[model samples]
Target: MRKPNAARDQLLHDLRNAYEGGASIRTLVASTGRSYGSIHSMLIESGTPLRGRGGPNHRRRVP
Candidate 1:
């Protein structure tokens, strides 16, 4: 059996909960002191079902 990674698992859990609680990746990065890419990758690895990108609909505006 492999050694358990409690800390990493907890981080993944916390990230997942925070994400499901509507916390943005940027916000999570700031709060967790983790890099944007690292946090984003973690969120994906943790299966957070990332929300769509933020900002106004440029396609709608250009139409």
Candidate 2:
């Protein structure tokens, strides 16, 4: 498999910014046409905090 492109990284950064600015995941996904899993993984890799943290199953703090 080829390495991930800069588009993915840039998309992740844009998604992170949109998310932090109060945009919903659904909105971002719809607008960007990116998968939720990909977005989630990007956030994980980029160390971006989840918009809604502290859910029932989420114990990992966003720090």
Candidate 3:
């Protein structure tokens, strides 16, 4: 079993690298074995800037 603090540290480290490396939340979920909500929450808790819902001109796209 993983220790709680160690796991949290590792998660933070991975989150920084992955987020800076342009890995999407879905990708982080697949790699970190964490849920989408968990990852999103952690990102917020860590003060990591959240990306917008879509790409640059996504809002301009037709439904």
Candidate 4:
């Protein structure tokens, strides 16, 4: 699969920074209008230490 776009990565970075700076999930959703699940996944993939089974735990990629 193709890599994620640079703009998207930048947005992800910005969102993470905002989240780290005490912005609530609700506030993030309101400000960016992004779904909670999408934001959560981005945060996880961006390597931000997250709660619960944050990483891809055990599933293997198919060749």
TM-score of each: 0.80, 0.61, 0.70, 0.68
Better of 1 and 4 by TM-score: 1
lDDT at residue 50 of model 1 (Cα atoms):
86
Q: Give the per-residue lDDT of model 4 (tens digit) for 1-63.
A: 758799988988997898778776667888888898888888887777654433478888899
Alpha-carbon deviation at 27 in model 3, angstroms: 0.4
Number of the candidate with higher TM-score, 1 or 3: 1
Descending-lDDT candidate ranking = 1, 3, 4, 2
| Candidate 1 collision pairs | none
The alpha-carbon root-mean-square deviation between model 2 and the true structure, to one decimal in Å, is: 7.6
Summarize candidate 1's per-residue lDDT along 1-63 as a digit string, tens digits: 647699998999999999999999899989999899999998898888988897865655544
lDDT at 37, model 4: 84
Top-lDDT candidate index: 1
Relative to the unseen true structure, what is the C-alpha lDDT of residue 61 in candidate 1, on a scale of 0 to 100?
50
Error of 4 at 58 (Å): 33
Instruction: Give the residue spans of candidate 2 off by over 4 A.
Output: 1-5, 53-63
Worst 10 residues of 3 by lDDT: 53-62
Candidate 3 lDDT over residue span 18-61, tens digit each: 88789999999998788999999888867788888766755556
Taken over the whole model, the C-alpha lDDT of each candidate is: 0.89, 0.76, 0.82, 0.78
**Model 2, span 1-63: residue lDDT tens:** 759889977877887888888877777778878887877776777787786643488566988
